[model samples]
Target: MSKNNSPDSIIRDITREFNTIVDSVSEESNFIHDRYFRFAFADPIRMAELLTLFSRRNASLKAFLDTIDLSSLRGARENHSTDKHIGSADLVFEVDLKNGGTTGLYVGIIAEHKSDKDKLVLNQISEYYHHLFLERKKDVPVIAFIVYNGEKDWNPLTETHFADYPEFYHDIGYPFKAIYLDVGHAIDDSEMKSLSPITLVALTAMKYICAKAQYTAPRSYRQVHLPLRLSA
Candidate 1:
């Protein structure tokens, strides 16, 4: 196959195209951020690549990703109910996994983009789990990814706690754990170089907006040209 037609090459091409779209947009708002994340990760291949790259440091997550059938990756409809106070996740995905040829094991991935510190972040994730549980009518495993691009050094899992429940901390256990990715730190991480072009560009743009500082692409991403063209 020609070099341009290789899998990695194709990914790069798509990444550039997406970047162009992002560059076309002028104003930045929560709606824009949500749309950008949903549009960028809607593609199963891109979603799989992102999960694999970010989950590498975590053994459990890495193992889970390994079992996922990439072909079976797809966006899942969000479930919402005002009566139950359940809210939708920024992005939800379902992927099938191989389990010794047993009945298919489907996993739910919840991606939440946080550009600021929210003390209620855990509660937000819990709502997602609750909604999914009700929708599936079964105990399905979920992996919540909190993608943070804010300037503050925040770790919800460590910094936040249930309200008035210090005594119940030991009694309470959540069915899902969150994987936090701080974009500022991620940009400096050498491992970021391994990320697909689209993922890298998205992170770079987020950091720029959140920091409100002069935007300079990391050296590794310079090949793609700094200040990548974005579109609405």
Candidate 2:
């Protein structure tokens, strides 16, 4: 397979189907709510569930990447030490090829997901990228993505745009691509039909969270922190 962007048709169908399933699942689980879902440090279980969902999506993403020639597709690894704040992003992931004992192969990605408001994950991704830089000993091509399940449109207020956030000041040696995976966008009828189960779960969580976040306590970015361990 070649490394091509997902076909527009595929993207649309996947998004559409996913939205349908989420609506169905939410109804069955009685997961529908109107309050904003807060991703505080106190809610570790939700964080773990979110991480597991993301890892599952990463598998799908890898398959999508394979269609475009990306090799050595692998699973996700949560970097507990690299959480955005203390409880904001559930976890950061490192997805890469099977390590071949090479010093600088530059094949992995660093990612974060949020189900809460009040946290600037774009800035957080920047911080995590730096952490990876120090740990990996190389910029190593990094792809950063955020699965945001917020209700209202969260136009990023930072100097960071989704396409350029983590890569804003990154060197050419360490290329990065940032994308915002909006759950709302996933359920839009025009785009939800082809979404995989993993993406559907992400959107469902987003729907529930966004519904809950509206009335929750305001979360300060500085105090945001990811959990130390992922839930089972």
- Give the winner by TM-score: 1
Total clashing pairs for each candidate = 8, 35
User: Against the hidden reference, what TM-scores do the models get?
Assistant: 0.70, 0.42
Candidate 2 local lDDT, 128-200, one digit each (tens) = 7766664657656666656556566664433344446477654333245665556543444333234443333
lDDT of 1: 0.64
Tell me the tens digit of each residue's lDDT in model 1 across 1-232: 1246565665555565445434533444555565566555656777776777666665666777777776788877663233211247877778788656557678888888777788888788888788766556856778788878766788887763555767668447567867777665555535556565566666666666565555533323334554434321
| The 10-residue segment with the lowest total lDDT in model 1 | 78-87
* Candidate 2 TM-score to native: 0.42
- C-alpha positional error of residue 222 in candidate 2 after TM-score superposition, expressed in Å: 38
Over 4 Å off in model 1, which ranges?
Answer: 1-28, 79-87, 99-101, 188-197, 214-224, 227-232
